[model samples]
Each structure stands twice: as C-alpha cells, then as structure tokens.
Target: MNLFARCYCRTYQKVFLLARRFLDFSEPDLLEREGALKEDLPATLKMTGLDHFFLVISKFLFDKGVHLEMEKALKERGIVLTIYSDVDAEPTFDLIEKGVSLYKESGSQGLIAIGGGSAMDTMKAIGARIANPKKSLPKLGGVLKVTHMPPLMVAIPTTAGTGSEVTVAAVVVDKANHDKFSINDPKLIPDIAVLDGSLLASLPKSLIAQTGMDALTHAIESYIGHSGTKKTKKDALTAMKLIHEHLPSFYKDAKNVEARDAMLKASYLAGLSFTKAYVGYVHALAHAMGGFYGTSHGWTNAVLLPYVLKAFGKSAYKKLAEISDHLALTGKEANPQTKAAAVIAWIEELNETFGIEKNFAGILKKEDIPALAKHAEKEGNPLYPVPKEMNAKELEKILEETMG
Candidate 1:
C-alpha cells in the first residue's frame, strides 16, 4: 500500500485500541477503595499563590472547595502538605532552582501543583530535580531526557487552559538568553488530575477568554497537525465541539458552573490530544513570543491564531474544513480555501467577542522579527508537525502582519 493508506490503517488500529481503553473510563467504585490506602504517611507539596486563594475560598464553600477537600482527603490518609509559593510566571531557570531548593528543604514525598501552566511546570521541574538531584534542568530538555521517575504528582489546574495538568511535558525558560525549552517525558504526566470547575469560578474575564482560546487552539492544532492519529482526532474533535458550544457562554457568564465544567473537560481532552499528536506553528510562535517578551501564552496564541490558520492554507485546510463542519459552519461553501476562511473568520469573531486584540503591535519589536522567526523555525521544524514548512523569510512576513 501507499504511504497515505498505511497512515490511515495505523489510525484505524489506534481507534480500535482507544475503544478498548474506553472501558477503564468508568470507575464509580474506585474512590472508596482509595480511602483504604490512608495508612501511608502523606507528604504532599504544592506551590504557593493559588493555594492561599483556594484557602480563602475554602472558608465559604467549606468541604465543597478544592483546597478544603484536598486537605481533608490528605488528612484522612495521614499526609502532611506543604505549599511552595516562590514559583513565578514564565518560570525561569533561576525560579526553578529556587523551587528545587524549597522542595529539598521541605523534604516532601509527593507533589500537588495548583495553578496555571507555570506552577505545574515548576512543580514538574522540581519533581524531576528531586528524582535526579545532580542533573540540571537545561540538561533535561528534549524528549525522554528525564529517565528518573518523579514522585506522585497531582495537578489541579486553576485555569482552563494549557492542559499541562494531563500532558507529559514541562517547559522551562532560560531568562538570561531568552530561550524556552521543554522536557518531554511520558513519565511527566501527572498521576492525578482534578477537573473541578469550582476552582475556575474565581478566574478573571480576560483569563477566561484567553485560556478558553488556548484550549480551542490546542484542539484545532491537534486535529489539523500532521501527526494526528485516529485517537487524537477523536479527542480533538470532541474538545473542539465542546469549546465551540460552551466557551463563549462560560466567558460571558463566569458563574455558570455547567459551562465552566464543560470548558475544563474540553481543556483536558485537548491537552490529552496534543500530548500524543503534538502542536504546530501556533504553539511554536507563541512559545517564542513568550520566551522573548514574557507575554502570556494563551493571549499570544489568541492574537496569532487567525493569521497562522490562514497561512496553513491548502497544506492543512482539508482537516480544517472538517473542523469547520465540527463547528457547525456547514453550507454550500464547499471550497477548501473558502471553508478555511470561514474558520478563520469565526476565530476572528470569537476574539472580538472576548475583547482580544487582532495585532501584536506594542508587544512585538520590528528589529526582532528575524530573530523571532528563526527561533520559531528552529523549535517547530521536525518536532512540530506543521503542515506547511515555513522559512524564516515567510515567517518574518507573518511577524510583520501580526504587528499590524
């Protein structure tokens, strides 16, 4: 058979595998048995900031709050919990060092990270460092570089984006050099993921918008990216459908717990999809921009999503057209380019609905375009399954357009 046929065959096989694995998803009775394991002494550590916020919220909600539930659950199991809050956004090498220092000082047996991607990544770095005490984080960059297994790590994501809670990757920055790199290891996937929407009720509107878009991007990119498998496509499409249905409503009505729960579930599904299929140009560019300017990843992607989708063009539009249908944008506009334009237009409209900017003018420097394009290409090519290979010159033009 031809290459395309072989790829489809593999995809079908994966779908069957996924169907078999779906049986494990129903575990209604497992929680009570876990209560039996309370004999093990608990030594859990999570990062600082959101935990404090969670504590304050826990007071009003009592047992309903995530922090309170966590404390109660740990207490039942006899686990001592510590909060390491020195972690900051755009977790630099220095910040990771501080976290590692704290983790060692605390001598915690396990980790419970509560926050956005930054806190989770910092916690992952510390877990890896604690497992392999002598190796530096920079040395752990790239795929499966971390051979040592970290302690039991549970992730409770406060934000509904990044899917870092379920993914097997951790990003760390070298602030001195404006370089961002990742540690990709299957072992890095969190042992537990808490998808409690109540945790997200306190998020600001801007955060809700940006992170929702981030989850949407993850689903779209995973669906259209070259690395897509049958299983990843299913996950991505499900996530896309959820985001399309609930994200805007959740953004407008933050108190809607049902919408919040759907968004969080969508984020988890998107995260799981991308972990296997990987992301493409949007994430590559967002990572570069964040590393260079300390910009927010979700907001950066929100700004660049439409432009990148347009550039993806014929190379990826077949898959994107399927996504347009998934978004319920079906009509007589059967042309691939037309469908792609419709998808981009829908995203542009979504951004406007959320008050996100269409340009990167103030955030991007003119002189830095070449460097930014070069770095983005270096990070994306061969690793990311970008449907169309983008050269520096072409990417420079995109940067210029983004600056508009």
Candidate 2:
C-alpha cells in the first residue's frame, strides 16, 4: 500500500476504535446448557410474548430432524413456529429475500436461527431486509446501513465456530456478481444466544476440527490486529487458551460434554473479540474462496491462517508471542520471533492432526488468483486494522503460496 493510503487506513481504524466505546456492543442474554433448546427456548419465547416466530435452520439439520424436540416444545407452548430450512452452506441475497418473504407471510414477529453460521447469517440478513424495506441487500452491505432495529433476534449455534450467535455482522453472497460482503451494524447482534452442547454430538469429526480451528483463527487474528482494546485482547487470550486445551480433545471425542461446552464458550468469546477488533486477510480471503468455490469457511480459515500470519512477519511478532505465552505453547525464555513461529507452527500442527490439506492446490484455480486477491484486498484494507497493510499484489502472493 502507498504511504498515504496506509496512513489513512490506520487513522480510520483508530477513529473507529475510539468511537467503539459509545456503541451498544452488548453481549446477548445467554442460555447455556445441554438441553437449552428443548427445555428453555419455549419458555423464553413465551416470556417474550412471541406467539409466532420464524425458525431458520439449515436443510441438513432439518433433514436430520435435529430440531424436532424444539419444535415439539414450541408446539406444546402454543408458540406458532414457521420453519425456513432453505439456508445452505453459503447464504445469498436471493435466499435471504425468499426468507424475508416467508417471514412476512407467516406473520412471524421474531426470529430464531438454529444451525451453523450460514443459518444465523440467513436469519440476520432476513431481519435486516425486514427492518429496512427501503434498502436492498447490496445497499445495506457496508457499515451501519441497517439504521432501524430489526425484530427480536435470537441465535442458536449448532456448530462451535463462526460465532454468528454474537457477532455484529452478517455475511451474504451476491451470486450474480460472484461477490461476498458483510452487513455490519450494532443492531445485527442477536438479542439472545443459546449455547447447547448436546447439539454438537452429531457433528462430524472433520467439522469439529475445522470449526475449532476457525474459533482459534478468530482469537489470533483479533488479538494480533491493531484495533484491539483491553477487553478484546483479554477475551481473545481466554478464547485461545480454551481452544488450545480443549479443541484436540473435542476433535477426538465429540461426546465429551465438557469439551463441547468449553469450545462453545471459546467460540462466543472469539466472536466478542473479533466483532469489535475485527479480523484480517484470513477472513477476507476465506470469504472470497467461499463465494467462488463454495468452500467451507472454517476449513479455508484453517488452511490460510498460518500462511497469513507468516506473511505478517515482524509486524505480528509481539502479539503472536503474547498468544504463545498465553497458551503456554513455547518456553518463557523464547524470543518474540521464536514464540511467533511457534504459534504458527502450532496452527500448522493442528491442521495436520485434523488431516486438513496444507494448501488449496486442487481447490483454488490458478486463474482465480487475481480476482480472489482483489476481493480480499477490497474487503480487508481499511476495515480490518491488520498489523501489516497489504495491497492486492501482496495478498496475491499469499494466495499463490496457498495455491501450492
């Protein structure tokens, strides 16, 4: 990046960080337990006087009947439920519009998203459309465009990643343009978040590994970013510690309730950290890959994280060293560079342990590098507050490395 542009980006990030204090970045009312969905969701809905609400879920979970118990409980409580299970691995503007139409026709007064990041993002985008009928999804794509409050929003994360349950942003794909973007605003934060550990029991081992690494990426990226605050750093460190200690165990044994709960909490804390501090090239690149190839977001993050950190080099040494110390991944006597390298090595080890590919060799086409790098540069630049400023050419080099 040019000196002028780099200075402008840093100045913008500093201003946003300063203004963050006055924003209502509140944590959701948390209902956490093994059976919160079946036992508590109904009662909570009744208490909130929501007679009818939209229940957004992924088709995979809906097909598996994972939501049956919750549906039965809601039925027993006389809380009318409208199910929208069209959400896929990536949510698009058209899909969100379909959901908005369904929500309006169903007479739903609130929204409850039950699945992974895609489902939660779908629900949030639907709410954004409903609240801002005058603005299209593209127009609402940047910062704080959803000026009005959406309907009462609740998020239930079935996966231990993405932390869409507590984030202030909703990622939506524009399939027509083959683009992915985030609609960011404080109003998009969920009013309630249900952390049910039992829901994770059925997740595949690969998913557990991917999502666990995704949470870890969130922590590291936010912690290393220049926009971090005291609270964000504290939360990020705590999240990293939890993921380091529990992710491998959870990956090996999905039935471990304690590990499941800890991972869920870690994901939430990572979300809290990154929502304020923001993520950098890893997320931007991952989003671009997701938009183009329909790749798994968590898996892409897991693959690109170490490479991006390595690219950051000296700029990220101090923060990565702090993370290494926090996770006890290196000896106390290690220098900052050594500690940072250890942190990157740890991420690579985690990926190898999970059987994730070291690069995107077959998945990412050579021809797509320029477009992908451009998309990543556009998404990241001013908003991300990365420790090192990288332009399109620089990001393309990292992409080339990932292309193997």
Candidate 3:
C-alpha cells in the first residue's frame, strides 16, 4: 500500500498542480461600516473557523448594531451569544477576571472580538482564561505558558492600528503594580482577522491621525528591525508603501472610502509584518511611555517614532539608506545615516501638522527614566537593532530632545 501510494503521488504531481487552480479565489466582501459589516455578517461567519457560536463582545463598533446580528446568527446556530460592551482603554487584570466569568457563564465555544486594538486584545485574553479555567491570571504571565487557546477565534478590527488582531503579544496593565505586562505567546494569534475599511468612515480626525501613524511606525520599524527576515521586510515595506500612498489622503478626507480601505489594508499588513519581524526602539520606548503615562498607544508611537528613527539611523545606516530610497527622500550626501534622519524629519513634520506634542522630559522626572529605561532594556533591548546601547543618561537625552 505504501509503495502504491508513493507511486501514485509521483504520478499525480502534474495532475495536482492543474487541480489546485480550480480552487475559489473570490472573497466575501468586507464592508466599511456596521451596516455593511452587519449586512455581510453571514459571509463573515462563512469564513470563520469556529464550529460553535459563543460569546461575542464589541467595543466601539457596538453601537453599529453588530450585537443584533451576532445574537441572531449565534442563536440560529443554537449557540449562545453574550456581549460585554465595555472594553477599557487599557485593560487590567480585573478586566480579565470579569471576562473569564462572563465566558464561564455563557459556556461559549469561541469568542468574536469586534472593535479597536484594546477590545480585540482584551477578548484574546478572555479566550485564554476560558480555555484554562483552573489557572489564575498571574500564572499566565510572561511568554509561552498556555498550551492551547480556544479551538477558533476571529478578530474584527474597527480601527486601523495596533494590528492586535494578528499579533500574539497582548499588553495587559497591572494597575496595582503600576506597570504593563506582556502576554507573549504565538498560540494567541487570532485564527482569522476581519479588516473592514468602511467601518472607518465615522472615525474622528484625531483617531485617524493617531492610528494611521501607528501603522506607519509598525511598517518602518518592523522593516528595519533585525528580528525580521526577507519575507518580513517585504511585508513591512509593502505596508509602508500603502501608507505613503494613502495616509495623507485619508487624513485630508476621513470619509474617502478608497483611502480608508488602503489605510486599513496597510494596518493589517503592518500587523502581519510586525507579528514576525517584531518592532524596534520606537515600540520599546512607546511601551515604556504607555506604562508610565497611561498615554494612548498611537499617540505614544506617533511622538516617539522620529526619535527611534534617529537612533536606528545611527546604527542601521545601510538599511536606512535602502529605506530612504524606498521612501524617496533626500539624504546627506554619501551618508547612509542621513536617510534615517530624513525619516525622523518627515515624522516630525507629520507630528507638527497633526498638532501632537512629543516631550517626555518634563513629564518624566530623571528618576523615572532609569526605571523606564531599565524596564525597556529588560524587555528586550536587542530587538531594536539600535546602533548604540542607550543607557539611562542617553535615553534621557532622547526624551529631552523629544520634548517640543
């Protein structure tokens, strides 16, 4: 039988190639707003991998009437549907505790998270607890502990940043500890991510700016960071290209469906890129800012992105030059590092246009920088591939310079 199978496999290689081309390539239309996403909810369900309908929670997208669609669909499938509408800006351990109990009571087989990054990430954690009921929240701390998550999970992002849908790491704040902890595990990757650009139509200009910039930072940093491979660089670069083409237009016209769709696509691409490549100094510094100031994630990234570019240009000179050519920016003659500085200058200009301030020097005292820097260092300093190791003093300089 084995010999026959091998002979048949060899005989069918060409046949299989021809057969594979018959596969369907048409995708379910991803809608832009709640009405569109709702009208097309059945199609989204068709793409989902989960067997049993379970609890569904929405954050910003709730008022869009997704709740009714989910309730109706789940009930039709004879599955339970429970909605936890309130997902905080930065979820704490307490949020996990509440979500776990909600899952326990609902007895749902899977979870559907429809919202921005915070809601999406919180739902991921909620799914984790339901999968591992006996373990307390603290046990799941740090990297690689949970063996398996729910059999299926689907993420729908209403916003264009964080890429939380595709990312494995979820940041959960420990309010009592006055810090944020990383939930690092590849298993947590959402089985499916639904990025609907039409949902971005009503987004306020402020959010549009913040999330779009966050996506840009993800693309640039992921491409430059050494954690990535050739494939990672491609994904990041593609993401960057999308941003260059569409971000300014999206900023100018928040309701432009074409630009909105492109921005959303860029965010998803950046998420996929960074999921493997990992982010660099910008994210590390942003993470610290998030912990210290409870600042908006996009705002932190927006403010710190230029500084990180400067730092990376100092080290990843050749890579930065490549990026400069890729991005088509003027640079110092014969200096690879100049390209990165150009990148920073571009970011600074964007910041000024958006009226986003970037000064941590006054906000964080000298005493705070050491702890933040130390925590950042411990979190994986080498991830950035930064030219020089920034000590407390050096980090302070970055912070001071950023205070405009």
- The best candidate in terms of TM-score: 2
Per-residue lDDT of model 1, residues 103-206, tens digit only = 66766666767678887887788778778787788888876678788877767677888888888789998877888988877778877666666667777899
RMSD of each: 7.0, 1.1, 10.1
Clashes of 1: 2
lDDT by residue (tens digit), candidate 3, 249-322: 88888788888888888888788777666676677777777888888888888988877667544566777677
lDDT of 2 by residue, 175-206 (tens): 89888899999899999999999999978999
Q: How far is candidate 2 from the true structure (C-alpha RMSD, Å)?
A: 1.1
lDDT of each: 0.74, 0.92, 0.69
Q: Tell me the deviation in Å of residue 134 in model 1.
A: 2.8
Q: Once superposed on the true structure, which residue ranges of model 2 sit more than 4 Å away at CA?
A: none
Score candidate 1 by TM-score against the native. Answer: 0.84
